[model samples]
Target: MKNIIYVVLAMLIFASCEKPNKIAFVNNGTLINDYQEKKDVEAKFQLKEEAFRKRADSISQAFQEEAQKGQTEAQRLARSNRKKAEALMTGLQQKQQQLQQQMQVEQQQLTQSFQSEIDSVIVNVKNFVHDYGKTNGYNYILGTSDAAATVMYGAEQSDLTQTILDALNADYKKE
Candidate 1:
């Protein structure tokens, strides 16, 4: 009976000595939005988009001028050769269609490229968080966003969004 009591006491002491699991939660939206690398990536893409828009505008203006000249020449030909004028108009229409298709393809490619870069940045941020959790001895780190709240109510003490953001920005500055 004394041995049993001693064993029970030892078990209780061991259990009490075990460390509790460390868990934390971060706001997903805030973490990503406030990341310095993400902001720089977005700014770089914005400049590219602006430059693309200017080039597209210039191409459109040049096409318009060419079309106007074609129309004038077609009208002049119509007085002497009606069939030739009709063929010229048809050629102009085909050219316009080709330009529109090319522009659409360019725009789609640009959008896809932008999305890919953004996705990569998001993955990097997630990886950083994962490493941070591991380094800080976190057993679990929940992510909550306004769009999808995985963590509905974490205590302020357990919220590591700002802390993680600051660390992430500092890491980015180093890079």
Candidate 2:
């Protein structure tokens, strides 16, 4: 019984003497959304998206005008000849299909470009976080997410969102 007590006391003293690990956490959602570089990236992509939309709208307007002309001609032909009207209607539908396919191709291309750019940004953010931790002498820089309690309980003092954001923004300009 005395040996057990001595062993327990020695273990307690050893544990108490060990230095606590240097640790901090950043909210991943907050980090990405409020990141300055991310904002700039989004702005650039948004411009591209708007431009695409404008071009698409212009094409759609032209297609609509063509359809209206075809419709009017179809009405007149139908009154005179059913076979001619059917051919006109089929031709207009083919044109509509071609226009739709063109729009889809353009939209897909834009989407793919945006996705690749966004993915690159995400990778840079991860790299920055890793470098930040190493340079700051952090033993562990945990990440939390707004969608889930990745870190259910952390002291407010350990939250390093603003610090990382500041470093990220400053580095972004240099890049």
Candidate 3:
């Protein structure tokens, strides 16, 4: 019984005396805010959005012309033509809906692509940090998101955003 108590006390002391490992944090916001590749991706999406807008404008003009023709015809013929115009309008609406859906899918794909890029950047950053830590004799390194939970605040001066962004941009420039 005494030996058991002694053993428990020794374990507690050892646990209490353990030294904390070396740690560093990475901010996710830095990747979005400072990364040139992220800016390029956003620019690409904007161009796609503009193209969609132009297509929609042409569709709208065609619909308006057909609707105006129905408005100008005589009453008897107008009824038949109005029905046809309505059908055409319905088709146009469907086309518009389809275009909107396509745009949504494209937007989602763009978001996914950006997410993938961010993940790849994170992997590269992790590799660089691992190598840097080893070369500099750091025992452990930690990464924090934009919120910087473990580290409530880190100065922009200390932020490694530019370094990581430059590395990512350089790598992408090669490809």
Candidate 4:
């Protein structure tokens, strides 16, 4: 009977010694938004967007002035020279189309450039998170954002947002 009791006690101790799975969660919104590179890239893109808008506006204003001038000359010519005024108007329309096409091209290029850069930044952050989990012995790392939370309920102790963010910032500084 004493041996049976000892065996039961040993089994209980061994079971108690087993560690639970390591898991943690990071706030996705905080991680992405607070990241320095993301902010800097956004600022740079905003400046580029503003400059392009200004340039397009200037071109548009010049085209408007030319249209107004053409209108004035057409009015001065009367119905006898309607054909000449119509031809001038056609030429003005072509110029406006060209200006619009040019603006569209510029906007597309800027958007692609910004999107590619941001995508790369996001990939880097994801890799950092993966490595962090592997190095820290976490079985899984959950992400929570405003849109959705991979981890619906977790203890505050299981939150690793600050730790991951600090590691990420440190990694960025080295680069």
- Cα lDDT, model 3, residue 156: 61
Q: How many clashing pairs in candidate 1?
A: 0
Best by TM-score: 1
- List, residue by residue over 1-175, the lDDT tens digit for candidate 4: 9999999999999999999889899998899889888988999999999999999899899889999998888777657788888887788889889989999999999999999999998998899999999999999998999799777898999889888888898889898
Per-candidate TM-scores read: 0.88, 0.85, 0.56, 0.85
RMSD to the true structure for each prediction, in A, is: 2.8, 2.3, 5.5, 3.7
Each prediction's total of clashing residue pairs, residues at least 3 apart in sequence or on different chains, is 0, 0, 0, 0
Runs in model 2 deviating more than 4 A are 1-17
**Model 1 residue 110 CA deviation in Å:** 1.5
Candidate 1 overall Cα lDDT vs. reference?
0.93
lDDT of 3 by residue, 1-175 (tens): 9999999999999999987665545565765556666577667767866876687677668756755664444344546676765665566568667766876786687678767866765576567667766765557545567565666776664555566567667766887
Clashing pairs in 2: none
Native-referenced Cα lDDT, model 2:
0.89
Q: Identify the leading candidate in terms of lDDT.
A: 1
**Model 4 global lDDT (CA atoms, 0 to 1):** 0.90
Q: Best to worst by lDDT, what's the order?
A: 1, 4, 2, 3
Query: What's the CA error at residue 66 for candidate 4, in Å?
Result: 1.4
Please give, for residues 1-175, the per-residue lDDT of candidate 1 as tens digits.
9999999999999999999999999999999988988888889889988998899899889989999999999999999999999999999999999988988998899899989988998998899999999999999999999999998899999999999999999998998
The alpha-carbon lDDT assigned to residue 13 of candidate 4 equals 98
